[model samples]
Target: MANAFERLVEKMDRATLDRMGKPVLINDVGFVAVESHLIPEMGPLTGDGISLVIFSSDYKPRRNDQTVWDGQSYIVTRYQSFNGKPQVWLE
Candidate 1:
């Protein structure tokens, strides 16, 4: 199987992302292996089809729209002056 870093390198390419259609996140939460698939979101502002990742010690996913009221969604909470306010979504 491809390691998580390899997967990210391949998937994060702009060309790759554009062609792959929208990404759908399905979390079995606590499952042992990773299995990703594509799904169409019913509407906008619900979340996006593309997946954004934030990895730390492990490639723990916080798939699109998966955030709960605990409040760790993709929404940017802070701002920056000169450059992109968005943090490097990956650690």
Candidate 2:
């Protein structure tokens, strides 16, 4: 049977991975994950929008933990990795 990581990789298309997915350092670990171009605003200016989504084979972030991407820092607000690839949502 295919493992979770394998399933995730299989589901990812070459074009999407090549275009949108970029390698970034997560907790200093290198991973090819998806990052959103739109940056969420802080404070009262912040709107109802998801900040970032990370697609990785085997990386999970605890809620409220800080993560760095593209030289910027963000906090992980939600995540799920039961199906295939781990999907992390940043706030």
Best by TM-score: 2
Candidate 2 error regions (>4 Å): 1-11, 36-53, 81-83
> What TM-score does model 2 achieve against the real structure?
0.57
Model 1: per-residue Cα lDDT at residue 37? 29
lDDT of 2 by residue, 1-91 (tens): 9999877766664556788877666676777776544444533534554444455656766787677766777777777663355666665
Prediction 1 TM-score vs. true:
0.19
Model 1 residue runs over 4 Å out of place are 1-12, 26-59, 62-91
TM-score of each: 0.19, 0.57
| Residues 1-91 of candidate 1: C-alpha lDDT, one tens digit per residue | 9999877765654444355433322232321111122355633433333223222223333324242222223332322221111112211
Candidate 2 Cα RMSD after full superposition onto the native fold (Å):
6.0
lDDT for residue 62 in candidate 1, whole number 0-100: 35
lDDT at position 64, candidate 1 = 41
